[model samples]
Target: MARVEELLGDELLEAIRGRAAGYDEANSFCHEDLAELQAAGYLKMFVPAEWGGSGYRLQDASRAQLRLATAAPATALAVNMHLVWTGVARVLQARGDQSLEFVLREAGQGEIFGFGVSEAGNDQMLLDSRTVAAPQEGGGYSFTGTKVFTSLSPAWTRLGVFGRDDTGAGPQLVWAFINRQAPGYTIKDDWDTLGMRASQSCTTVLEGVAADPDRVFRKLPVGPNPDALIFGIFATFEVLLASVYAGIGQRAVELAVDAAQRRMSLKTGRSYAQDPDIRRHVAGAALAMDGLYPQLESIARDVDDLADHGSFWFAKLAGVKIRATETARQVVELALRTAGGSAYFRGSELERLYRDVLAGLYHPSDDESAHATIATAWLGPPED
Candidate 1:
């Protein structure tokens, strides 16, 4: 497997990093960054070599995302959406299910996949849906609902969307992909936010958007089930998302150390690095991060190796994402303090990271959902 540095490269990273703040300040999408990443074949990291890709695994891709986010969180995050789909296909295909092999093949051919699963006010993500999937002729389903936070909105060639189908015996969740040229949908330009602005994750309104028969993928029951496709999506999304924020935490630690080493104590005639209080603060953050890194790695490795956590899988995936994101937020706070007042400025990298890390709170499997999942696994479902 090719290492992330080799694919992303130092020069490419510096250029992308240089453009990050401009994208944020202008509240624009990272078009240049996306073009560069595509040119570098970053999208094909998980596709097999036979399909013109690097043939890497989840662990490798997670590390790549970490490194990418350290340089540019918003850019990395926007790109993360695409990687999630590819990674999901990789996960499912590796386990002997080729239902999504076309995803890999197309991604290998340079097509970008946008994630369109998220729906506003629908917390039972993946397990249920609010988007309506009305059955169409020839086994197709026309999805009609709004998809929020549609990352890679400006560049996706195929969008992976899901909805609920009532025509079935019971409510069945339908997962499908629609082409960007599909007529009935509209991509709204409404992504201005506190941070991660470069992502340009706009809202996509599906007015009976058409998902052709062949493009429609999984159609499982309305609630949780032991489907491999669901597992692939859940595992890939949690692990990769964790990697991005974990990168933020790791970078924050570095910045904290750098700020401490340079900050002078007016009364003591020494750097803050020599101050016990500052040292302890930084060390505490570092300890949290040290634990986080391995947790992320172990989970990614497990997904790659297909380690059977069985019922514990959801708990572990949820736990790692919760830990990586929450830890990153705390670490960024320490970095800001160490960087001293200057970091409060809008253009400061630490300031950017501080805002970027906040998005982690909104990702799927939120605290309530994640805790509920973990509790149910350990304590069994609560009595009716």
Candidate 2:
């Protein structure tokens, strides 16, 4: 924690926060923030130390991400995409799988990775893909499809994409990494949105983009199964996403506290903080956050320690994400109420947080998916 604080000091966070509003207003990518983070080697935090990285464990990385999100949620969210790949590699390495070693090497070499697995209306999550993976003569595949919400689109050098490879006897899912310089790929600057504008998660159009055999990492059955790659992706993505939202909730509570302490009530002729109602609101937010912090940390620690949860791991990961996100949403709402009408302004941090929190609802393992997963885990899969 001290190392993380030293790396991302107050001066740097102030600088990042100073530029956050401007970037969000313009709906632009946080290029300067990214450059600063890259210079500090923050981008390679998960890469193994032997590969010239900090090699922090999953728990430490989650803490670092939480702190980063407190200053700039959009920047932290964009960086999450890059961390996801490196974290996946680390997860596999811990499991004695060297399949994603190249990811660590490339990330240490300053190559940013982005996730391109999401597709519009494809709510099956990783279970299926709308993209077509046309097999080539020498074992490579050309993908033709569009991937949505591709954060770090403008900056990533490598993108992890998946598509259906039906050339075999049965329909197989192909997961691979594709170079950004590859032909037939276009990054659209169509990221105008309600919030988290600095993320610049634009739509990526792939028209026969080629991924060499070396980059094609996994070929697994379509539906949910016990694949290490799948587990790594699910565990890392959900936990980190939860961490980001939890930070937002933390910041909201702090803001509410500050507002309450400073606000004056003419009727009572005293500070709002002295009022029971204001204190109760702040306490409620604090209690909600208190419950979330332990869960987020415990789950992340379990991943780092490689605690055996067997088939229950998926449910645990999904539960953490769902809980953290919903809790953050509730906390932010309370903060806005505590802050009064001032928080309703367009440029207000609380307003931005309110909109940013909405994004969590749309991420993987959403409420619907999470509930179903938990139910299935507790009471077997539903009969056909």
lDDT of 1 at 189: 87
lDDT of each: 0.93, 0.92
lDDT minimum window of 10 residues, candidate 1: 1-10
lDDT by residue (1-384, candidate 1, tens digit) is 677899999999999989988998999999999999999999999899999899989999999999999889999899989999999999999899999999999999999999998999998888898899999989999999999999989999999999999987789999999999889999998998998899999999999999999998888998889999999999999999999999999999999999999999999999999999899879988999999998999999999998999789999999999998999999999888888999999899999999999999999879888999899889999999
Cα deviation of 310, candidate 1, in Å: 1.4
Whole-model lDDT, model 2 = 0.92
User: How many clashing pairs does model 1 include?
Assistant: 0
Enumerate residue pairs that collide in model 2.
none
What tens-digit string does per-residue lDDT give for candidate 2 at 93-120?
9999999999999999999999999999
